[model samples]
Target: MVQVSESLFYKDVLLVFFEKEGYVYSNSSPTLLENIAKNLNNLSAPASAPKNFIVVHKKIIATSAFAVGGLVLTPIIVVGLIQAIGFGVGGIAAGSFAAWLMSLNGGATAAGSLVAILQSIGAAGLTAGATIGTGAAGATFMGTAGAKLFEEKSDSIMADLTERMDSNPKGQAQLDEFVKVYEEGNEDKNSEKGSTRVVFEIRDKLLTNNEAFKNFLETFVLAYNASKKLVNKKQQFKFFVDKTDKMDIAGKKLENLNVHLVKNYGAECVDKQAQSCTIMLNCSNL
Candidate 1:
C-alpha cells in the first residue's frame, strides 16, 4: 500500500475516469509501470517542452516511487501524455484520442499500428524498443501543448472536498474523520485491511447518512476499484512467476529456465489454474 498526495490523488481519479471510458490502458504490468514511471520521471524534456506537458509530467510522478494505487503511472505515462498534451492545445475526449492515434498509422489502428502496439504493450509487457519509443514520444508530445489546460477549476472529488471544507464546518468535520480513518486503514499492517476495505467502511459508517458524502463515495469508489485491479494483477503475475520457478525440466536449471518460461508463457498461464498451467508448460516443446 502507498500513500498518495492530494494532487496525485486527483490525477489518479482523472486516470480512473480515462480508463473507464476506454481512453487508455491503466491496468498495465507492474514491472512495465515502474520502469515507465522511472524513465518519464527522470526525463528532462528539451526547452521546447510545453508548459502544460511539463506540468502533467511533474504532477503524475510527484511521488518518489511513482505509485498511486499502482494504476495511475502507466496510463498517464503511455497514453495520457498524448491526451494531456492535446488537452493543453484544445480539449480531446477518448474518441478524439483514438482518432489521433489512428492518424499516426495513416488512419488505421489495425495490427502493427501505434495504437495496436500500445495495446499490445499494455496486454503483454514492455519491450526494450517500446520503452525507448514511449519515452521519446512522451517527450515529443510534451512540446506540442501549453499549460492552460489544468489552470481551470477541477470538478474532482478533492475539489469537492476542498470546497466543502471551506464552506461547511459540519461537512469538513466529517471529511476529516473520513481522512483519518482512511489513513489509519492504509497504515495498518494487517493483510486483511486495505484501501478498498477502508473505503467501504467509510461509506458505510460516515457517508451513509449524508447526501454529499454519498456523492463523494460514488466517485471515490472508482479509485478504489482501480487500486484493487492493480493489486490483483500484480499478485497474479507474482504467482505465475513463482509457479514457473518450481517446474522441473530436463537439461535446464530452474533458475535459468524460469525467466524464459515466464516471459514466453506468462500471458497464457496467468489466468489458468496452477495445475493446468503446469501441464501446459510441462508439455510445451520450449
Candidate 2:
C-alpha cells in the first residue's frame, strides 16, 4: 500500500484548485487561483503533427476500390446462383429446337443444323462462366482499394483536425472551462476519508467525451508540430485543449485549426534545452 501524508495531500489539492481558477500575477496583487487557471490552460495543449498527404491519398484510393468491388460482385453472385440452378430452361429450349429441326428434314442438312444447335449450347455455357469470372474480379479489386482508402482517409482526417487546432477559439475556451470543472470535481472527490471510491466516480465522468476529445487533441498536436518550424525559432510554443463533450458539439467547438500547410525543416530552430515545459490539463468529462 502507498501511504500519503495529510499535509502533503492538502497541499496538492490547493495547487490543483489554484491552477483551475486561471490565476495571474500583477504588479500590485496576484489572484493566485485566477493565475493558476490561465497558466494551466496556456500550458496544456494537445499534439499538433502535420497531416500526411500520402496516407490520405492512400485511403481514398482504397475506399474507391471497395465501392467498385461491392457494386460489381454482390449482385453478380446472387444472380449467378439463380442462373446456375435455372439453366435447365436453356437446356430444354435447345432440345426442343433440335427436335423441331429433325421433323423438318431427315437428310445431311438436318445433321448440319443439329451441330449448329450444339454450338449455341456451348456458347451459352461460356457466357455464364464469363459472368462468374467478372464478379470475382470485381470483388478482388474492391478489397484492395478499400484497404488503401482507409489508410488515406485516416491521414486526411488527422490533417484537417490539426489545421483546426491552431486557430480554434472555441476549443481554447472549452479547455478553460474543462480545467474549472476538473478542479472542482477532484477536490470534491478527494475531500473525504477513503476517497478512492469517490475519485473513481469522478474519473468515469471525466471520460465521457474522451474519445472525441482525444481525436481533437491529436489533430491539434499534429498541426502545432507542423507549424513550429515556420514561426520564430525562439518563440515558445503553447497549446490549450479540452478533453470533453465540448469537442463533440461539432460546429460550435472551433475552426481554422484543421488546415494543411508546408514548412521547411532545415530552416527551423528546435529548442533542445527546453525540457521542463509543464502541461496543466483538466480531467476529461468524456
The local distance difference test score of each candidate is 0.34, 0.30
lDDT of 1 by residue, 1-286 (tens): 2334433343344333333333334444444334332222222122233354356467644641333333233324544444433422233334444344343223444554344444444443334224535444544433332221111111222343233233444433444343222212233253333422222122222222343333333444344333332222211111121223334321122223244435544535423344432211221112
Q: 180, model 2: CA deviation in Å?
A: 10
Q: Per-prediction RMSD in angstroms? A: 20.9, 27.2
Tell me model 2's lDDT, rounded to 2 decimals: 0.30
lDDT of 2 by residue, 108-200 (tens): 232224323333333365454344356556455434643443233333333332333334444333443333212122243423433221110
Give the TM-score (vs. native) of candidate 2. Answer: 0.19
Off by over 4 Å in 1: 1-139, 142-160, 174-180, 185-217, 225-286
Error in Å for residue 163 of model 2: 0.9
**Which predicted model would earn the best lDDT?**
1
Off by over 4 Å in 2: 1-137, 173-286
